[model samples]
Target chain A: MTGPRYTPLVAALPATVPFIGPETQERARGRPFAARLGANENVFGPSPRAIEAMAQAAREVWMYGDPENHDLRHALAAHHGVGADNVVVGEGIDGLLGYLVRMLIAPGDAVATSEGAYPTFNFHVAGFGGVLHKVPYKGDHEDPDALITRAAETGAKLIYLANPDNPMGSWHDAATIARMIKAVPEGALLVLDEAYVDLAPAGTAPAITPEDPRVIRMRTFSKGYGMAGARVGYAIGSAPLIEGFNKIRNHFGMSRIAQAGALAALADQAWLAEVQTRVAEARDRIAAIVRANGLAPLPSATNFVTIDCGGDGAFARRVLAELIARDIFVRMPFVAPHDRCIRVSAGRAEDLAAFEAALPAALDAARRSAG
Target chain B: MTGPRYTPLVAALPATVPFIGPETQERARGRPFAARLGANENVFGPSPRAIEAMAQAAREVWMYGDPENHDLRHALAAHHGVGADNVVVGEGIDGLLGYLVRMLIAPGDAVATSEGAYPTFNFHVAGFGGVLHKVPYKGDHEDPDALITRAAETGAKLIYLANPDNPMGSWHDAATIARMIKAVPEGALLVLDEAYVDLAPAGTAPAITPEDPRVIRMRTFSKGYGMAGARVGYAIGSAPLIEGFNKIRNHFGMSRIAQAGALAALADQAWLAEVQTRVAEARDRIAAIVRANGLAPLPSATNFVTIDCGGDGAFARRVLAELIARDIFVRMPFVAPHDRCIRVSAGRAEDLAAFEAALPAALDAARRSAG
Candidate 1:
């Protein structure tokens, strides 16, 4: 019997996930990964103070979180020198992206992004029935010029750019991004995803004023703050755009414990500094390991290092599969040219040692499989 | 100075919150609420096991929660004697409702619900640009037959009914609900929100099978489990309908700590039983208090009691405002007839004591102001 009918757009969309989580793989393989570095999660963990705050808040879960996300929003506003009205906190950047797309994109609207950028963003665009125009990467990094050109050509309403781009771990400096922001076509909102900016080198974030209505900057506690599972992310934009989120967002969606943890995490700058330093060390170790294994590690400004596999997309896939099979979780790019490399996140010394040990065998297995 | 343009529907929609949280009122009044009975939160709190589980999961927040929500979904399936595919969990019932509406309601699609049922449900339908047909409540209860008739007349894509309804603590029996389910119009889905069913009397819940494609039941950890702040809710329905959530849901949205807490909370059925008992006792106390103040307390089968103010909506409005001014947070229904009552949630003894202490003064203030 026929059940309720899905909306035309929803009916046309595929039932797919952007990324198969490492846990799903672990379940399928009947074992946990030896070194969990694939998803780029910060293994150093959130600040001890943040964990303590969450534990304390656990006993208070009977009450729904502040619908306004009052304290956290004010703190973030003060941190960024923006008014609280200029900041909007959500379940995550992914959730915010969905809301943003729904707010702007009617069916058949145009959106633009790099060919193989964050799939979750593309997923949102598609979910909202936005027609996506994909621009190719220039060398190892997303080409802002090409993306802007494509947006102008297609009359795209939104242009998504992730600073310190994922998959390749490449970044554009602040001045470069500032120039790109200037070049953005009129009427197109620039969505600057700064999920990795906390792990990027200085000057990676442009000094855009919060009242600039042309761009919305997304930041998350998921990466450098080491609270991905806490699912807290905020967007900084003009007051009108930020206020628009309240129209359609699940206003009471934030988890109370997550809010408390994020507040504490934001307050603990010393812990963040320590984690950054450790991440740097881990990156160096990962690079050395990759070089020793006959792969060239790409220059990275984020928590993960992308290494050129010295082959094509198929070869990189095989390498990734080999690593997964060897109990060393890793991932690679999704499109051509960029897929010639595999991405590995910075981890603890023991985790890196496990990765180091598994790399050679994984490479051997991949080579054997290719032959 | 123009920003990105919003879709026509979003442009037309007002940025409004359905409920003004007690916290926002506290901020405005510069004082905390003396007794929080406005929102139907279980002040008794979650199970000790849930708190411990959340605390334990706090340290693991660095990792993203499983995209599949495998363990929790499977556990819920086993608990309900349904297959895992019959269940889909989300950020909360609010989040899930948004997704469900988006999935089913195209712009201009017809939806049906009681005029002042759950405003949040109405909010979602409006957010999705659905045309909503409102039927008046039959007496104090949601008229299932009227809702069904309206759904058929309007060819509604979805019909929403909350068993053990909110704002007015009234409910219909299982046999009536079963008849309503059978009478749901073809191509229309019935959304059964059971947020308070855990506290309802035995035989109140209809014995609907999970495989029933015509209806989807929403359940949450926010009420009986005392985890409103945790933000976990699930929908149980036919596998096909449940699988549709994967097409548009924020796959990585669930909070890790919340997931762990809900799992532990579900396992501790003893805790749920005790909560039900406490809530029933609290409801009785609230009714006694209401009757003592020369108001009529409606018979309740939920966690709150709606007390008729023995006047008009205007009088009830004054009573509600007086309670708020007195730092006793209580809410009233939004429509006529029903609006002649104030809804107070079941709270701890101390909280209720504060409500009892303030009610006479609030009534006095209302009477004097009306004069």
Candidate 2:
């Protein structure tokens, strides 16, 4: 009873994850999923070179990773044509987002994001006691303009926009996003998440210089690079904004093997291009599967395809449950309207085939249950 | 441009490190260090089995780690003879410390720690806007009584005590630490950091129940397990206290390879025992080297020895500089009194041989420079 006491904010927060991981769900169900298309992880797997690098570095795990993340940052900077000072690497986009929110948000401060955007960002905003004003998605795509307008009205300090976005696989081209950044309003900073930029067509990411103080672009190794388990992500921005992460980040949080793996991943552009090709093929195949099921597939610039369930939220929920019951792991958005769609990630041919084979049965079961 | 704003406390804080990493210094020096004994990493390395497990898991890095860290927690709980609920695994002790501080310390709240102790803990407290109160070391050891008294005076919400402590490898027996834990002021929680305990002699850690609500004990594989680069650490406390971390922890931050590595490391008790034996031998060797050079080596229970240069902080610093100049990477405490001792970690036979050959020349060079 004599332990240190927690602050009111932390004490008030509940221990929760916005989404239950498939691993946890599998344990509960006593069976692993036949097809894991949820979480948007690259089931095509990382490049052989990245796997080799990680394996080689495994023996060197006794030495802490470079706190500066020097080599990886330099490689990333060179890849993006920026100075090393313009970058800071972290655990993942989720982890970087948490640090960004910590640096910029205080208790009861306002933050703006799409209502059905990445939930992890919202989790962090709430973790720091920030008051969030959520703008709903417009036409299945994140409405950057509405987000900026709300941020302006609320004097919000942070705005999140994921280009080639998640859950919906929608995108606004670079020029449009750059203009949105210009309209973010004074005192508010934009967090332009480009987690899926590698999967998007050229020009999807804005051409803003890394020195731009108005926005911090978040990129990750989890998707296109196929290293989600390595947990490497970085933020590119002005020197001050990037350096600001040092204020509260876990300085030695990164795994040495992960840094090596990510460095290898960044160096292997040919492999990245190949993965992009595979992801595109997978995206098309996913869309084909949705069409074969008589559902409308949204146009996707990212690695996933969002399929309209041709019904309401309830129907989508039933389809998702049926898919889970059929051992095909897939997910849907949390909010209304968007919840009418099921999101499936790009995966290996084998994994997608499992999904392809299981869908009709899952839909049939859902229909039977609905009846 | 404007964005969601930072809280006042976050805005007021400066980004800083308790210690500059050797890699950072290397970047400045434009070369890698010949010996990396500065960061208290176990150059002895992790178990072969651990290396193999990590390597095996490398290709599977495409999948996110189990967010619950269930398997690792279960293994840790079994290792400690406690229930699985009593343990929470994290990125490292550094990661757990940040979460604990965030949970307990808020703006203007008081927290106490030994002066010149682990600086990362202090960094986290400051990051959360907590007011810090320092208790000077007594006879180069963390004085638990003084810490308790300061906690009572400051009405501190948290107190940090590192046993088999860092910077200076001094420790109080379990009975003493248990007594101190009992005497902590009401509402002040004691954090018992036993990061070095596994390398210490028997009876170094307190005999506390895992379900004890008054204290939380943290351990790491970074030291004795020789996997610092793997970034795995755990905390043992009441279920409720352990659960509090989930409210804000990076759920998927752990590397899949790391989990496997740690699990393998934990299972290989014989490797740990062998390493402990080696560490003890190295400790004695370091002490003898110090004595041969006419310096004083403090008795140490941890993997490193702290040697007093028999002069002021400047003289000790000069010795450190000379060592680095000779390609021997060693470190020292950052504050007065404690800064009089240069700390050297246990290294391999060849590394120790290099340290042995460099010691006299470095000392002589340091003397010349001082003159």
Candidate 3:
């Protein structure tokens, strides 16, 4: 028998995994990595209170989670000093991105983002048959002016900008971001993704007003709160815009454990401060390790540090392979210039210790392989 | 300035909630539900092993869930005697329905289901601009023949049928389902939603093969497995069709705790059997309670029973209202003919006792209001 009739758009799309997960690599290697510093997971883990909350929630999973996400919304609103109407929650940033793309981008609609930004965002755009107009990173950071220019030129209805960007761990200052917000073309909605802002320095985030029509910002518990496995993310915007999510979102999609865990994590600011300190220390240690190997570590406001290998893209690829062979799990940027650097997450003491011991031999092997 | 520019279809679609959760109702009444039987949740709860697994997974929340869903897929495959490629896991049946509709039904494409079938399915159809053709239920059962006929007539690309159906608590046996599958119009795929099948009789489900290309059947942990808040649902279909989900789904949407819990729940068949026995006893009790109030109890293969109130839709609605006012959460169908009933789930002993105590007054109040 023939199969179901897939829509033309879906049929044309390839089954691509946006990110090759570390578990997949582990399976391929037939064993687990000694250093799990890839995927950018917080090695510090979630707050003890958050874990306790999730355990309590696990006992009550016989009932469905509130479809309205009411408790979490009110809690998040109170946390942000905005009305509950300004917030909407989803499975994670990935899930929210899909819903946002579906609501705003009809087939062939124009969307804009950096060429080497989050691949998950690009995956969503292509899934909805949206036309993507991308600007390359200026040096290692996302070029805000170029994105605004591309949006204006191509009439892109949605412009995606990740402050304290991923892959390169670079960010624009608050004033630069404010300028970018003003420069957004009239019809385009800027998606200010602040998934990492909780770990960034003060003033890294611009002040947001719920009624400000220019942008909808997203934040997640995945990076800073260290609950990536919990899969909680939320968007803040005008009431009407937030309410529009009701038209297309999967109601009752959130896991009850996730909601309870995120609420507890958000409440424990002291644990977050401890994580920030740990991440900073790890980042410093990572940079020193890179320097000892004669590689340059890029400036980072994010938890991960991107180290530039003293060679071309192929040399960086060899270095990455050598690292993987040495049981170190790390990733590099996908495109050129940026591809010359490999990214590493802030791991705990033993995990980082493994990385430090592996780097020298991995680098020497990469150099010999290139020669 | 205007907020984000929504696509014309989304702009036209009203912001609607398909189901009004009991939590929402409780908040409105500023109280808790004494007897919650509306949502058909498995009040008997999940396996103790599942709870322990979730608690353990909670401590590992620093890492993201395996995006590939490899371990869970293999487990489900082994349980079903199918290859891992035949199963695709999702947030829930609701989330899977959304993705299925997106993959198969392009804008303005035709789809078919019962007129009073699941509203969430209809919501997904409307969200994607699929034109839904509906046929009324025949003798309180979803008419599979009529659904197939309508699909053929309207060139519907997808036909939805829920065995052991919701609201009506009715089901078609295996042979009837097989005949319906053979009758599915060429180029149209049949959607067999067996969300409640685990609680049905021995011969209720048709035997399925991984190579079956004519239909995709969905199952969930929400009803019989007693883990509604886990948000785990899966579809068994041809490998190619199942793979198509990778194109649009939130790859990492499944929560880590949920994955671990569902895997544990699936392994403990004894727990599921115990829940089934408990549900059957509760259903019988519910039926007896309804008969005591002079209402007719419909025969059910599902986890809930629908009681005919011996009056019209409006009368049944009044009865439902009185029940809710008494802090007993019950629901009635929305459309006529079928709407003469109020549906209740098989709650535990205390919850059912609360239901038994509250019904007589609710019936009297409804009659008094009608008089």
Candidate 4:
């Protein structure tokens, strides 16, 4: 019998996942990492109240989660000072990105993003057969002007930008982002992925303009709120745009535990502050460690630091391999110039200490191998 | 500025969600449900061990769930006696169906299902712009023969069937299902949703054909495992079809607590058996209440009972409205014939008692309205 007939797009797509989990690497290594720092997850953990709320909700797991995600959306609306109609809750930023792309992108739709930006966004665009026009990062930060220009040039439907971006914890100032928002071409909508904005400095994210139909800002509970495993994320946009999600989203996709945890987490801003403090401390420590090891740590506004390895991609890959061998789980960028750096997450003291201890030996091994 | 440009498919789609949540209903009525039996969720709840596991996993919410879902997949494979490569886990059957449709159905591709089958499936088909060919249910059951014929005639890429079906609680025997599987037309795949199979009688499910490319069977923790809010469902099919999910699925969509809860729920088979027993008893209790009210209760192999109101769809709709007026959350089928009945979940004794107390008045109100 013939196998399932995949759509031409799917048949041509590669079988590669966006990110491999640290757990998979641990399993393959036959041992867990001494310092789990890959994938940019908040290693500081979630609020105690969030955990308690999830525990309480676990007993009621028999009922389907509110299909409308009623309470969370309202709370988020109040939090963001937007109408409830201006927000939509999703399983996570990843899931939200997928849904958003599906809503705006048909086959051969033009989409644009930085060449080394979030691969997950690219994955979604390609999944929908959207032709991507890539703009390379300028000086390690996402060049907002370049992206807007590319969007206008390509007549793209969606353009993605992450403030305090992944792989390189560089960010654009609020004024720059606001300027970029204003410059979005008539036909294109900007997908401002603020997944790391929670961990960024106060001036990093642009002021909220919920009715600005030109941009939809994505926020998540995964970073500064320290609840990545909860899979709770939201989008803030104009009412009509937000309502469009109802036409397609898996309305019952959010777990009850996620809703409760995120609700509790949102209520505990003090806990978020605490996480921010911890993350800031961890970032400084990571930067110091990188400097001590003779690598240049890039200025970071998010929960991680990207260390310029002072070498090419091949040299950085060797360093990465050596670090993995030394049980220090870390990642680097995918494209050139940016790939010259290794990205490290802001882990707790002991976790960072493991990375600190392993780095010198890893560097030595990489150097020896290069020679 | 013009609002976000929606794909033509999304723009053409209605804002109607597949199901309006009970929570939304509660909010609209300004009161909580007295007995929430509308959604067919297991009121008996998840296994204690599953709750315990979720509670434990809550502390680790800072980390993303494993993208590969290795441990859970291995366990599911072991449970089903299938190779791990034959299984694909998802947020829920709803989310999986969306991904599956996106993978196999380009715009205007043909898909077939019974008219008034699962609306969420229809929602996904429309979301992907799949042209659907529908056949009428025969005697309140999904007619497999007609569905296959339609698929053959339409050259549909996907055909859907649900055993121990939703809304009407009707089912075909295992032998009939096997015969139907063999009848699936060339270039078409059968989506056999067994969402409620754990509550169905033994010998109701066909024997495993893990390598068979023509049929993909969906199973969930939402029913007998009593974890609907956990949002975990898996598909078992040929290795290639299962792997195709990697192309477009939210790879890290599953929550860590969800993975943990489902794994624990699966291990405690005794709890599943216990839930099955409770569901059977509750079904009988519901049937008795229906008979006492002079309504006709359909035979059910699933967790809910559908009672014919002895009138047309409008009469059943009035009964539904009256029940809602009394704070009893229940549902009715959206299609004719089946729409002549109101479906109620197999709630616990106390929940059923609330329904029993409310049903007489509800019936009286409906009759008065009908008159």
Candidate 5:
């Protein structure tokens, strides 16, 4: 309390974490969860090649990573069918989003996001002192039209939207999203986050022209590639937008081992395809578990399924708590309406088995606790 | 640019890199540098045990690092003889400095530093729109008294100092620094960057308690520990100061492999001592090389030698270019006085041998070119 004072923005901010890690929850509960099916992490793990690359590159961690991120960017460009100038690799999509907000938003500037879209994004905007204007989700999905309208109304300089969204597991098809991008008001940049695009059906992602400067697309090795811990993410846009990152990014931020692992992850299309299939199967299994528990599961294009608890947010919160108490790690949305649903990530068969066995007793316990 | 327009701050920033890496320079030159002495990277590499631990942990890259950084922080606290609450691990000293600047500096807020202090610190201050007030170095060393006076005069929120300083490689003893700390004006936070402290002699570092609230001490594995690519650094201060970072930090930004690597790096004190000895030897060798070429080498407590070219900044610039032409990578200070000398890092025997062979030739070339 006697420390030299913080700047006004930092002093005014509450010491809040964007998400409670499952580890913290487990420690508080005095035991590890039987089913680690929260946080949307890929329980299936990374590709064998990626793991081997990381292991091999680990020996060379003594040498600082290439500050330029030259090799990874080149490899990513070839894999994605774009020029190297179109890509900028970073710690993760979360880290990249932080930098983007820092670059584009100043104090009191308006930024637009969907309500309950991604708390992490909102956290970044708040961190940079931007005024966040959230558009409510329309029918359990990110409403691009609403976001565009809000951006226009607020004169927002930045807008964030995640296709194949989290929590609600909703998406907009390519043409619909493309139209939305075209409709973005002047001076507004659309941050189209496609973190879950690999798990989505064909045409779920817009055909973004890398030459187009109006929108930047973000992707990661965290989801379908199953290397979340590797912390490799990239943003793709026009040369100018990509170049701007050089002005302020941690020059040597990328880890050599991570760059190597992500390069292998990008090169292995077969592994990604297999991961997508496994993710789809796990999603269906989770849906089946929800049905067995007499709850409805939303159709999902991502690695997680959102189950309606058949009541308000309070009931969903109780269910989440009961699941945690029963050694099942899961989460619920934060906003009302969406908060009525509990989210479960795809995990291994054993983890799913644990979830399936725990659901009934957990639900009953939640009901008793609520009463 | 037809792209989404950037905010005025971002648009005003030139797309610039702080330094062109040796690799990039080599590529442009169409040949590798015979002596890799620039950028201050440890050519001696990291502890073999640390490398082994990193490689071992690479298999577990599927799991995100402990966001609490519990194990690493506790280990660092024990190593530094402080409580865990006093330490906060981050990407690097560079990264932590960015957060510190963001926390204490607002647009148009004044900050003070030595005229030729670490450019990265100045970069961070400028990035946040802080007005930089520099105190010139007295006798090629950072003048703490002058810096304190400048801070008081300008009502600066933050002041930066690098002990066992960079560029000119000068240092102040611990007692002098403690005295300077006591003299610091009220409301100004002194940032002591001790990145090179491990390579310096005993008693060269101030003995301020880690719980001291007025000063934030930064340390890194990027220097003597030889894990620059790992991107691991930490700051020691009061609990409140440490907690302030939780307000806006990238919660999941750290790499699993990096944490494991840095943890191992910190645990190996024997390896650190050995590296310290080796760095000292290399510094002596570099000084010998400079002496052989008839240039004066400044006494340094850091891991590099600053060799006076015995002329003006223009002459030193010519010498640097001549060395670059001769495929020896080295750098010079960006500001006057200090810029009159060229900095060369301590490296392996082979790297020093390369420097030995090229120096005479480079000097001759520089003289001819100047004429």
Candidate 6:
């Protein structure tokens, strides 16, 4: 018997995952990584208060989480100096991006993003039948001017830009981003993904008003707040744009324990400051290790540092594979130029020590394999 | 400075929530629900082991949940005697339903469901610009025969049926359901929502192989598993249909803590048995309370009992409002005939006592308002 027919768009889409988890790799290898430095997850862990809140909330899982995400939205709005209507909390930045794409992108719609950028956003756009236009990074950073030019040329409905961006770990300051925001085409909305903004240097985030309908900024608890497993993230935008999410999002998707943990994490700013300090130290350690291994470390505003392997994309891939084979999890960019570098996340002292210990052997192995 | 234009379909859709949560009602009423017997939550709560597992997982929130949900899916597969390829886990039944509808229903695709059935399914169909053909319920129960006939007539892509159904707590035997499954029209997939099947009597669920492509069965942790707030659900179907979820679902949407909790809950079958016993006793208790109030109680195989209010829809609406005014949070059906009943969830002894104490006063108030 013939099964149900999938929509033409869905039928044509490939079944693919944007990123593979470390756990999946571990299961395949039949052993866990000695140092988990991939995926840019904060190794410093969440605030004690957030942990306690989640632990306590575990007993109260009999009731569904408040579908409105009332208290978290209010708290986030107050934190950002905007009205509650300006914020919409969701399953995470990944989940929120899916909703945003669904709300705006229909078949044949044009969207734009930087090449080698967050792949999940591109996945969503493609899933909804939107055509994606990619703009290459200038030097090591996302080129805002090129992205805006492409959007204008293509009449893209949405354009995505990640500040303190992934893979390359390079960032444009707030002043530069402010200029880019104004240059966004008249009808195109800029999706400003600031998932790593919390760990970025001061003045790195632009001073955009909440009522600017031209841009929606995304933030998450995964990196700076150290709660990736909680899957809590939010978007800040104009009321109309934010309210539009209510038309299509999964209203009861949030976990009650996560809501409580995120609320507690937002309250404990002191703990966040501690995490920032720890992350900065870890970045310094990673930089030193890369430098000691005779690699060039790029300037970073995020919790991860990208180290140039002094070779082409294939050489960098070999370096990453050697590191993974040596029981240290690391990743590299997918496109050219940036693919010459290996991305390493800031980890705890013990994890950094393991990475430091493994790097020389991994480098030697990569060199031998290349020869 | 105009915002991005929404697709014509999205622009035409109104923003509406399918279920107004009890928390929303409490906020509107400026107080908390004294007895939360409205949402069909299991007052007996989750297993202690599950709570402990979640509490432990709270400390490991620094890492994202496994994108593949490999461990949970394997456990679920083993429990159901199905291969891992035949099962797909998601955020919740509601979330999965949205994804399923998006996969099958393109703009103007036809779908069939009983009128006034699960509104969330309708909401998803409308959000995706699908045309919904609704058939009226036969008596208080969903008529699967009529639904299949309509599916054939309309060439509907999907048809929805909830066994041990919500709002009315009515169900059909497995033998009858097997007949209905055979009659499902060609090219149409039947969505068999078994949300409350865990609380139904033995042999209530139909014996269908996981390889059956004509029907997809949905099960959840929200009812008899007593973990509503965890937001975990799974669907069983043929391997192709199960794998198609990867094309559109949020890969990392499941909370890490919730996954651990659900895994532990599944392992503890004794806890589920105990919950089933408690739920049955509570149902009997609720039926007794309704009889004592001079109302007719429908025979219930689910956690909640639907009581005939011995009046018309308007009179039942008054009773529901009066119950809410008296701080007894309960709900009723939305359509005619069924609207003559007020649905009450089985609760703990104290919560049931509160409901019992408030019923007399609520009835008196409703009668006075009618007069």
Taking all chains together, the TM-score of candidate 3 against the true structure is: 0.99
Between prediction 1 and prediction 5, which has the larger lDDT?
A: 1
lDDT for position B17 in model 3: 89
B221-339: candidate 6 lDDT, tens digit per residue: 99988999999999999999999999999999999998999999999999999999999999899989989999999978788999999999999999999999989999999888789
Give Cα distance to truth, residue A19, candidate 1, Å: 0.9
lDDT of 5 by residue, A1-371 (tens): 24576788888898888888777787688888888888888887888899889878876666677888888899888877899999999989989999999888888999999889899999989988899999899989999999999999998988999999987999989999999889888888999999999899999998868987779999998888888877899999988889988877877778888989988888889989998889989999999988988999998989999999998999999998888888988888999889999999998899999999999998998898888
For candidate 6, the per-residue lDDT at B101 reads: 98
The DockQ-derived docking category for candidate 1 is high
| Model 2 DockQ class | medium
Full-model lDDT for every candidate? 0.93, 0.90, 0.93, 0.92, 0.87, 0.93
Candidate 6 structure, TM-score to reference: 0.99
lDDT, candidate 6, A96-196, per-residue tens: 99999998999999999999999999999999999999999999999999999999999999999999899788899999999988898998999999999
- Model 2: DockQ against the native? 0.77
lDDT (tens digit, per residue) of candidate 2 on A68-88: 899999998898899999999
Better of 3 and 5 by DockQ: 3
Each candidate's interface RMSD (Å, one decimal) is 0.7, 1.6, 0.8, 0.9, 1.9, 0.7
Candidate 3 - chain A - TM? 0.99
Cα error, residue A217 of model 3, in Å, equals: 0.4
lDDT of 2 at A234: 95
Residue A102 lDDT (model 3):
90
The list of candidate 1 runs beyond 4 A from truth reads none
Q: Name the regions of candidate 4 deviating beyond 4 angstroms.
A: none
lDDT of 1 at B245: 95
| TM-score to true structure, per model | 0.99, 0.98, 0.99, 0.99, 0.97, 0.99
TM-score of chain A of each: 0.99, 0.98, 0.99, 0.99, 0.98, 0.99
Clashing pairs in 4: none
